[model samples]
Target: MANYKETAKEVVKLTGGKGNITNAWHCVTRLRFNLKDKNIPDLEKIKKVPGVMGAQFSGDQFQVIIGNTVVDVFEEVEELLGGTGTGEASSNEKEGIISKLMDGISGVFTPIIPALAGTGLLKGFLALAVLTGILDTTSGLYQILNNLSDSVFYFMPFFLAVSSARKFKTSEYLALAVAGTMMYPTFLDIAKTAFMDPSVVNMTIFEVIPIPYVNYSNSVIPIIFSVILLKHVHKWVRSWMPKSLSLMFTPMITLVIVIPVALTVLGPIGSYAGEYVGKGMTWLFDTIGPLGGVVLGATFPLLVMTGMHYSLVPIAFSNRAVLGYENMIGPVNGCTNIAQAGAAFGVAVRTKNKEMRQVAISSGISALLGITEPAMYGVNVKLKRPFYYSLAGGAIAAGAAIFFNCRSFGGGGMPGLMSLPAYVHVEDSMNVVWMAVCLAIAFFSTFILTITLGFQEDAAEEVIAEAAEKKAIKNGTKHRVFAPISGKLQLLSSVNDNTFASELVGKGIAIQPDNGEVVAPISGVVSVLPDTQHAIGIVGDDGVEILVHIGIDTVKLNGEHFDFKVNKGDHIEKGQLLGTFDFEGIIAAGLDPITMVVVTNSSDFVEIMNANDEGIIFKEEELLIVL
Candidate 1:
């Protein structure tokens, strides 16, 4: 890779420097920036930086694709910037209520995804173990595992209180203390008694004012509202309090004043609000049946595109909390996600663009894991038609799911193929089967629809020139080589090593090898195998010249580390093992171990089109289209 520090500096500069950036966050593959002014950053300049895969603007945030090494790059960038500006402000553009609500929900919940997903996976596994009789409930092991699985959800108010406090800009400890009151033993006991015996008269505050007997365990809205209220109250209290007494008295007065008000006002209001919303949703589903599912599934993709799907997160939890099972959100999420994957797969199969095909396949797998942003932004949305196809497919599958009465007893972090086991009802193994059926329906529907609808071909001059050249070479006219190693594909322009980056070794693609082994890219006679064995030149059929340079500066090792399988003038077929080098040794020697497969005689071809895809490549895979 290029010097990461230099890349960081360039990135910072191109993003209008540190001052222009308000906030910076990253997912697996991209660094998302909230900029003070979107127009200030130069998109093209950022994309041209070595190590950058691509860049784009999405949903009011600017994104820079950094591939797998995003974390390291993010650290470097963060250091260069020192500190960032305050968080995102609401958009001035007129947005629907649904859109605004979803944005707020996403802000509150996105920070806790790691904790949520880990516990959700654990719960899914625990459910599977008990249902299958692998673990008895009476066993000590089961009890410990059960607590581990339940703790997150049982005390969800505390977790949400902290996260929501951050989002609402309130005191975190104060929020937690407030949340604790909702789960206090006395309150829980009173709530439990009221739940079990409707006729019992609950104890009242001062024996005059009645307390709302409601359980806030595993509740969503109560904690969110409580923290939001805390934000305003804390600010008001802090403004007038003396600095010496501010820390102690502000918290004391805020907590003393907020707790009772929360229990008497905010808590009851939020609880009732959640309950009615759940009831309303249940009524809608019951009244409309399959149409409700169809509407949810079809609109889900569009919701996600606008960051509005998060609006359903609380609704799903509320339904589970009030009705003991959620039939709407989980099933529809699974269907929509599967449909996205299916559409991406369809694009992979139908598209002739190798880069598009590669992105489609990888992003499709990510979609199956319930992380559809890659599939959505990288493939389906980019292609246009596939996104619509996915939505249509999701609609049909959701209707089937609704008909089967599929339900999730607990909130799933992400409703995907792996988390389908979470849908298994204790008394019904068939629920899991139904979930699978829905997923299959979604996959097939979108896949078939995408193929039927097709994509508008991108035939830029370079693509057209490359296609014509490939055609000319294929019909008994010419020949080409393949990739020499298994690793991630990179452009020659993106390579870190100076000689390769400068294209002094001619034009071709680079491979960041995962293993030490190297193989012959094609049938060729080794024309120049140096004594050091760090580089090899091959003369393929019809005089196609190729070079395989193993490492950036491995020549200093002087043949000490390389194990050559073939010598100069040896004819090797495609996929033949060339040799293995010590990857660890190269690292120890302080040399970059990125390998380059270049067409040394590039001017000989009408056009040499490197595969534009950025993904893992295997030996003998088509690496370049040399005309």
Candidate 2:
């Protein structure tokens, strides 16, 4: 695998460096960067990076697709950016209300997906276990597992509090405090009693002012709005509060005001809004039937593309909470996901590009498992016709879903092939059968359609004068970089760090040094010499940028046992000494002395080839060819 750290650096570098980023966060598969200048990064080069599956601009977010390892890569990127990860985005950029809303919804909902998906899947399986007679609903284990799966959804406001706090840039604990008020034991008991008996209505705040006893559990908008209110309230309270007493009194005063405002006004408003929206969707779904399914299913891919899909996520939750089941929106989303996966598989079979085939197959499987961004952007959208065909498949499958009345009883996970059990109706086992049939239709129909109506794929490495390019390989106009240190030459992949090994920064080779001598790889000016004295960057006369890092992670030593002969901008020739490190000392410190010599600008060239394979070599031996 390409080293994640290096891939991260390359990702950060190609996104116009850390300075260009205003905010950085991630979703299931992509590293999302809210950039200061969206046009700065080279999207094409980012896609070519070894670990990046794809890249694109969605509004102000420059999304780098890293597949399943996105969290790992995002962590590395966070380290590179220091503590500025997820800082407040620049408020100056003008975006439509929908765009901002989508961004906000995505930010708030993304972090909770793992909890939701896991619990949701478990909920489905528990139903299966019961349906198969392996476990009884009355059994102790079944109840415990069932409640455990239900916990996230039952107390959803708390999760939203934390996530929305991060998005709105407020205190998470404070937000949780507000959610606590909404879900307080007293408040819950009163709301239950009031619901059970209509006469037991209002809970009074101050004798004259009555706060309605509304159940805020399983709620969405209330906590989010409370947090947004908290952010402003916290700031205002802190503005003039005495620094000495601020910590204690500020939270107290802030909460005293915010919670009452939330309980008395905001909570009721959000609660009613959620109910209306959920009821409205259910009514529309019941009334329109197949047309409702068709519209939602076909447009889902587009919603996902623009991140507008998240705008409906809150409504789905509300639907599950209020209506007790959803047969309208989410199942259609699952159908689209399956359809995309099917189309991706078709593209995998038909596309002659080896790289496309690799991406298609991997992305197809990911989409099948419920993550569709890879297949959607990497395969379907890129191939054009497959995306439309997949939509058609999704529309048909969704119509079938509604026509058959396939339903999701309980759970909060993405609808997909693995989540078929989510449709397990305790009262009607046929729901599962119908759900499976719908998904199968989505897969097979899209697969058949994609293969039958093939896309325009690039011809197999067509006559680029391959023979001629090979014959002109020795031309002086091409660039050559000599070995920088003496030892056993090895492929970059042999190095421990993935960044160099994966060639994500650029194509290069590694050298396991026998001695400490480091020399100029090409005759040009020294471009970068770090204060740490562990690496050197040189620009060759032919414009090939070469970076020779002395040892893996040797920068941690703070320049100890290392020396450089040339400063930045100094002239250098092939084999001329640039620096030296204590190879034995780095080894004693448990750091590898395997140096990586890379062409940092490898993307600008057609090919970057190593001069020789693994063997002992001197600093004077040819190391790389750029053509």
TM-scores for every predicted model: 0.67, 0.74
Which candidate comes out best when scored by TM-score?
A: 2
C-alpha RMSD values across all candidates: 17.0, 16.1
Give the per-residue lDDT digits (tens) of candidate 2, residues 409-449: 65667678888878886789899998899999999999999
Candidate 1's clash total is 0
Candidate 2 regions with alpha-carbon error over 4 angstroms: 36-40, 83-86, 352-355, 460-627
Residue pairs clashing in model 2 are 3-498, 3-499, 6-499
Q: State in Å the error of residue 44, model 1.
A: 6.3
**Per-residue lDDT for 84-150 in model 1, tens only?**
3355444355545654454457657766666666776677677788898998879999899768766
Question: Model-by-model lDDT, in order?
Answer: 0.79, 0.84
Q: For model 1, name the residue pairs that clash.
A: none
